[model samples]
Target chain A: MSGLAETFAAAAQEQRGVLIGYLPAGYPTHETCVSALTAMVRSGVDVVEVGLPYSDPLMDGPTIQRAVDASLAGGTRIADVLRTVESVAATGAATLVMSYWNPIEQYGARRFAADLAAAGGVGVITPDLTPEEGGEWLAATAEHGLDPVFLVAPSSTDARIAQIAGIGRGFIYAASTMGVTGTRDRVSGSAPQLVARVRTVTKTPVAVGLGVGSAAQAAEVAGYADGVIVGSAFVRRLLDSAGAEPETGVRAVAELAAELAGGVRQRRPRPV
Target chain B: MDPLPDPSGHFGRYGGRFVPEALIAALDELERAYQQARGEPGFTAVLDRLLASYVGRPTPLSDAPRLSEHAGGARLLLKREDLAHTGSHKLNNALGQALLAQSMGKTRIIAETGAGQHGVATATACAALGLECRVYMGEVDTARQALNVARMRMLGAEVVPVGTGSRTLKDAINEAMRDWVTNVADTHYVIGSVMGPHPFPMMVRDFQRVIGVEARRQVLERVGRLPDAVVACVGGGSNAIGMFHPFLPDEGVRLVGYEAAGEGVDTGRHAATMSGGRPGVLHGMRSYLLQDEDGQTVETHSISAGLDYPGVGPEHAWLRDTGRVSYRPVTDDEAMRAMALTSRTEGIIPAIETAHALHGALVLGRELGPEAVIAVSFSGRGDKDMDTAARYFELLDGPP
Candidate 1:
């Protein structure tokens, strides 16, 4: 099994949800992002996704969108993303890349897989590239022995879930809602049902993402999901704090990651 | 001669549903609804009546004798899409999609607009159908095309200004797509152009096909022969595809699509996707996109707000690759010049988007000489653009 699969397996054995955190590379600055991921890792995040910023992020809400836009304006490139991934991966957490498909398509999928693998990256989360259109990417990831994670939403049918499960390698990301990634007051009521639906088709571990912001929300998701994925919340923290003090921004993300990590480790017990 | 996009919505690997999983079911539902609606007798009857009465369809084909004489004596025929209700060809697709929304029992209609033409058209359709309407326009476009904003509001549609990510057509699309994802149950996203994920490119084209269908029959009946060439400007490529689809089988008719070249193609300040881009994915479809080396979509510039987009429709990419159509760029200077000449000679003012086609047609007319019968897709009227045109031409006396 791949290291990513092993991480999930270990988490399963521990009988607790795994906490996964996401941050865009070169957000604020390259060095700051590298330190941010390190701080997140130190705060008990079991895995980290270093986002490769793209110009058009259709699936992201305003928070991540603003972070990525700033990263791009700061001259963030694929190289910077890879460098951040390498530095973060050195912390021993299973590191993945969260990105749109175009950059990889432009970067040559095979070359991207090889470069990412060399950087200790274990997988890629492609928000836009469906399994139906991921033939070349699938082959490249297979060749590099890296995980090709795919997302399944509440709108996905059983057959569609099966098809995605058939292609997914690391884990199946289950979107908690039907909208773009952002912090919501409440996680959608449909998330647990969707995860249960996915479980009916594939044994692949399901990680719930989108709208997971607060620790309480993470704890709620951790009760039902194998993994809790938090993104826009962390991005919002960094963006809000970076205005005054960069160190405060980094500390804010780390503290939130730690709180979410605690939530995953000690999930709130549901009433009988 | 082939059915371009197969069942998977692929046009030679260009068009497909590359959107997030949240939008998949909505797209599938739209596809199913469109498939059923297109074949329903009741649906077609209402659509046909609406097209004739509400949209003022079967818009005339005008022979520009003076303009033709000015074009080195070649014959120029204008497919008067500019005369359509709401002053642009956008109403055709807007009305069709609005009716589709009505059929699906959707209460709200959402759309994204570049120059606000599509927003106004969608607002007009939603008003006619008694559905609530909202539009997302880039902050820059809303500022530039303020009159169109007023027109949309007057039609009872609310306009949301998108201030994120370049603040233009692309951002507006992103914002609208987000809205649809969040409100998929009660709202329908009426994509203005023939772009985005699957059903949209095909659906919008199907709605707008009346342009080519009418122009083809009119040209043959009036001129006693097929036109030598057809020309249209391509932004997201709705009008061009509409004007070109029915003529695809006509071997003798040459289809040319002109893209907006802001300064010049060589100057790196243009929206000529075909001329300046490589195949990539943006706005849910794999098409020729203007993006940087890092695959970040770059900001595009054009004097015409409608043409300032970083990507073209997937079908246009396929048509260009297949050599069934020719794509070229027209600089702002050339398009503006053609707009002035068209207004002066034909006494018909054209939207800046249409001026790109006029510029291309003028060049083609000069090349083909007086024997050639060229058809130009006059996509929109210039009343909304009079402010920009007057400012550019120094015709404005003072700040209004």
Candidate 2:
């Protein structure tokens, strides 16, 4: 079996908490993307998610959209994104791509899956690709040893949660709200309950995303699920430091990840 | 061969497929079906019967003598497309495409609309034909054109409001294209106008040709000859093409297309692509487009709901370039005034889109003189546009 999912699962088990980190590829510049991902892993991020920029991303809030626009303006393509992943994987950090469906369709699904897998991408998390429509993609992605992650929203029913979890191999993404992804002052009201409900279904690890901005929210979600994913907050940090030196943005994300990792490490159970 | 739109489907240099490899197969299929449907006797018979009985075709060519006298004594003939069933020429193309979809063994029809006119038309035809119908509109449009949204729902069509960028017509088109790409197996995309990738432009034109075909026969029977000038508004240019196609070979007939000048072309706030825009690619066709330097579509403004688009049909570009038809702009104030002028004088409330054509006839008639016979297409009725017109004219208050 591939060590990707096991690596994540083992980290969650050992830390008695979830590992979460984010990377907006081609942020500042594509030339520094690989180094950023490497810095994220070296700073103790368990799993890394590289965001693929889309022209029109309905699910993203302002902060992420601005980051995506900057990345696109810098000429980031799926090829460049996967190449960055390959370079980062050489340093041994498991990588997953989070993107909308348009670019994947534009690149041809089978070819995208094949190339990403070859570049050491472990999985893909497309917020918009529903399971009923993802059967062909599921087969294609599975063929290349790349797990296709699925998202279950608070609005999703128990049956839907199970259905998504069944098709999902990597961690199942649990959306914190009914609205698009954004930073929030607090974790969603139904997020913990939704994660708990998903636990009753397939044994797939659940990771709550969308609106979890601070280390406190990440630590809180670590108490419930396998992991917590932060995107908009990290993207905002990068945008703020855009005019500054290149390493500033990378160091910012790494600092946030280290802080969140510290919180998870403090609460984690001792391994048998 | 049609002398107006060449066999390659160029109005001059306007309409041709400028799409990726993924859509090429579908475009080719549509072109083949359209070409076959053109020469098929059964196809014409079915379309003709639908236009006659269902859509109430052979709409009167009423000589608007009162309105004519008001327009400097110029003779004006109204091609009553508004009198067609469902109160618009949209039904003509919708009914034809619905029939084609049924014949093609497709069980579902998908369409995208801006003001919901095309959605209502497609819904009505789908209800008539017992086919599943889905109409996508921008969320903003659904809110503004609520009555038409209700009309589509009442006709048993599923109305999906696209909530993407700007929440308007262009976004709705993008969403509809995505849906089509996903559901191409059993769904037939009934494009609303003579835009989009090839085959759609050609197919919609063929479906709408009845407008020109009937107007020609009606003009010959009524006036004993073709009109000296034919005028219609151009958005996606469907209604204009319907009225201009058959007369393309008629050397004596002069064709004029009216574009919407929202404020004024010089203010850079108009939908007058043919009048003020440059050649570019948009919505899968190369045409006269209102686009920025980066080829991003700019917002188009027009008082007329249907004519508010940043780009025009490819065929219209060809027609403008080849000098086969002259394109001019009618400002918002001009269209609104013409709407009231036609409504009060002729007791016919014309759609704002068609009012642009009437505004053109008012100007062209004086230039052509008293003996000039002019036919202007009344594309749709104004009932669907009462809210827009009432607000524009401030008719919310009691009589002025």
Candidate 3:
């Protein structure tokens, strides 16, 4: 099994869902980003999704967009993202890169796959790359022994879910709502139904993302999901702490990650 | 001739669904509604009635002898899409999508516009059909086309100015897509151009193709032969695609699309995607685009707000690759000069977007000589563009 599959297997043994924390590769500055991801890992983040800051982020909420803008303004490139994956993966957490589709295609597919593998990265999660458009990426990932994680939404029909389940090598990402990436006041009531639908279709581990912001919401999602993914919430913490001491922002993110990890480890009604 | 776009909405690997998975069911529903609407006379009757009575279909083809003289002596004919309601060919698409959305039980309409023509057209359609309308425009474009902002507001549409990433047409499109993703259940996004994922590119092209279909017959009746070349300006390529599709069967006729080169393509500031670009995906379609080495979309500039975008329509990308049609660029100065010349020679003030085609015709006229016939798609009028034109040409008797 690849490192990602093994990571999920190890989490399943512990009777707990994995806690995935995400932050852009270069936000505020490259050094601060590395510090934040390391802090998040030290606080029990099991997987790291190093975001590749992009120019036009259509699927993001305002907070993520503002953070990404700062990241891009700091001159983050694909090289920076791979370097980040290498460092964070050294902490023993499975590391994946969440990106929009264009940068990967522009940075030659084969070269990117090989370089990422050399960096000890696990896989890639493409929000815009659909199965119909993922033929090249699928081949590239398989050749590199990397997982090609795809997203399923609440709007996905059963047949679509089945197709995705059959193809998932890494955990499948289930968007809990039609909303973009932002903190929500409540965990979506319909998210459990979507997770139930995905479970019926595949043995592959499933993760729920989008709007899971707090410890309470993380605990709620851990009831059914195999992984609890937090993106904007982590970024939000760092953003709120900006203009303070550098270590202050890092500590804030570490604190949130520890709280979320506790929620993931909570005993739930559903079994792994 | 190849029976495209395919069932998956791809035209030779360019157009397909590249949207977030949350919007797939809605896209599938739209495709079904559109495909069924094409065959049912009940649907056609309503669409046709709207085009004929509401939009003034079968717009006239005017002889332009004086304007031809201003160009290099070739006989020039103007396809007057400017005469259509809402002052551009945008109405052709807005009405069709509105009717389709109504049939699908979608009560809310959303759209994005750069020049405000499409937004005005969409707002007009919504008013006529009694549906809720909301439009997204770049903050820059809203200020540039403030008259159109008032027009949309007066038509009962809420105009939202997008203030993100360059704050232009592409940003407006991104904002609209976000809105669609969040509210796909009861809303229909009326995409303005022949861009976007799947059914949108094909659907918009079909509705706008009347420009070419009517020009084909009218030219044959008025000029006694098909023009040697057909020209139109390309933004997201709706007007150009609409004016070129029906002429594809006429292999002898050359179809040319003129893209806006803000300064010039070599300066790297222009929106000349086909002229200076590589194939990449944006706004849900893989098309020729202006992107940096890292694949991030580059900032694009154009004197014409409509053409100031980094990406072109997917079908245009396919057409460029297959060598079925040719594309060229017209600089801001050249387009403005053409706009003024046309106004003086033919008493027609063409939209700056359409003036790009006019400039291309002037160049084509020089190559074809006096005996050749050229037909140009006058995509819109200059009423919405008065502010920009006045500033550019110092036509306002005010301080510079």
Number of the top candidate by lDDT? 1
Name the regions of candidate 3 deviating beyond 4 angstroms: A267-272
lDDT of 1 by residue, A182-244 (tens): 999998889999999988888889999999998888888889989999999999889888767
Query: Cα deviation in Å at residue B162, candidate 2?
Result: 2.3
Model 2 bad stretches (over 4 Å): A1-272, B1-13, B397-400
Recovery fraction of native interface contacts for candidate 3: 0.80
Model 2, B1-400: lDDT tens digits are: 5554565555555555543222444555667777788789999998888888888888888899988986667799999999988888999899988888888788999998887888989999999999999999988788878899999999999999976555677667766776664456577889899897766787888778889999999988988988999999998889999899899999889999999999999998899998888876556666888865434456778876678787788878887887889999999999999999999999999988899999999999889888888999989898888988888878887756
lDDT string, candidate 3, A189-211, tens digits: 77889999999989899999999
Docking quality tier of model 2? incorrect
Estimate TM-scores for all models. Answer: 0.98, 0.65, 0.98
Give interface RMSD for all predictions: 0.8, 11.4, 0.8
Worst 10 residues of 2 chain B by lDDT: B17-26
Worst 10 residues of 2 chain A by lDDT: A263-272
Q: Candidate 2's fnat?
A: 0.01
Candidate 2 lDDT for residue A128: 61
- iRMS of candidate 2, Å: 11.4
Better of 2 and 3 by lDDT: 3
